[model samples]
Target: MALHNKIGKIGEDIAVKYLRQEGYYIIERNYRNKFGEIDIIAAKNNYTIFIEVKSRSSENYIELAQSLYYKQIAHLRRAAIFYFSEKNIHLSLIRFDLIALKIDPAARRIDKLKHFKNIID
Candidate 1:
């Protein structure tokens, strides 16, 4: 794999750890369908959260938060719908969350992670 891809995977691992510590029960990691991939699917406060994790080496030009484009959101929404129907789960609530990770070279770790929920209507 390329270096960037490797770094992204590392960031995702960190995000998963962070979510677990925050009391989220992880149902799936890297959930994929014909549409796209959801970085994490977790249950929290009686709702299922579909997370999109974007990691970056710098906050230049674009911050990690900018990665959640509209097309991606649409794909995620479709995937979420498929997930619920395929599993036959009558869910009352669902959320789309964006997790941003910025890597700090000086600290040799992720400098920060931001979780944004309800990203779509």
Candidate 2:
């Protein structure tokens, strides 16, 4: 994998580990549909979460946030709707989350990880 892809994969693994630690049970990773890929899907306390994961090896947090545009978020929402309908899953408490990670790929270390819960609202 290229450096960026490597960083992203590593960052995702780190995010999954952190989420498990936080009492969330993972249901999926890299769930895909026409809209795109939902990086992580998990459940916690009766809430099903759709997570968008952004990862970077560079030290530019602003860049990472800027990379995800409004259109992308809209696509995610649409994709979430498709996921619910396709999987035949229903729950009153559903959430959209954003996980941002800054990592050192060489060492496979997560320098920072931020979980922004309910990002859609």
Candidate 3:
């Protein structure tokens, strides 16, 4: 795979591990539809979460938090609605989460992982 793709996959793996450790039950990864793609779908307590994972190496950490745009958020919301309907899930306690990670694939380490809950709404 291309270097960026490899890094993305590694970052996703790290996000999954972190989510699991935090007691989120992973329902899916890379969930997609005509609207867009959701990186992770998980359930915790009373919420169904649609997560967008953004990762960068230490060299690019400064660019991490600003990656998501309003247009992308709209797409995610549309896709999430489709996902809920297809899965027969209710929208009552749904949330959108953004997990930004600073990772070092060469060292197999995550320098930082920040979770922003309900980021879209």
- The TM-scores, one per candidate, come to 0.90, 0.93, 0.92
Question: Local distance difference test, per candidate?
Answer: 0.84, 0.88, 0.87
- Ranked candidates (lDDT, high to low): 2, 3, 1
Residue ranges of candidate 3 with Cα displaced over 4 Å: 59-63
Give the Cα-based TM-score of candidate 3 against the true structure.
0.92
For all candidates, what are the clash counts?
0, 0, 0
Best by lDDT: 2
Show the lowest summed lDDT stretch of 10 residues, model 2. Answer: 59-68
Q: List model 3 lDDT by residue over 54-94, tens digit each.
A: 88775565466678888998999999999988888766998
Q: Roughly what TM-score does model 2 have, to 2 decimal places?
A: 0.93
Give the per-residue lDDT digits (tens) of candidate 1, residues 29-102.
99988878889999999999999888877663136667667898899999999888889999889998888888
Tell me the TM-score of model 1.
0.90
Q: Choose the strongest candidate by TM-score.
A: 2
Put down candidate 2 lDDT per residue, 1-121, tens digits, no spaces.
7888888899899999999999999999999999888999999998999988898987765456557789999999999999999999787789998888888888999887778889787
lDDT of 1 at 104: 63
Alpha-carbon lDDT of model 2: 0.88
Q: Answer with 1 or 2, whichever has the higher lDDT.
A: 2
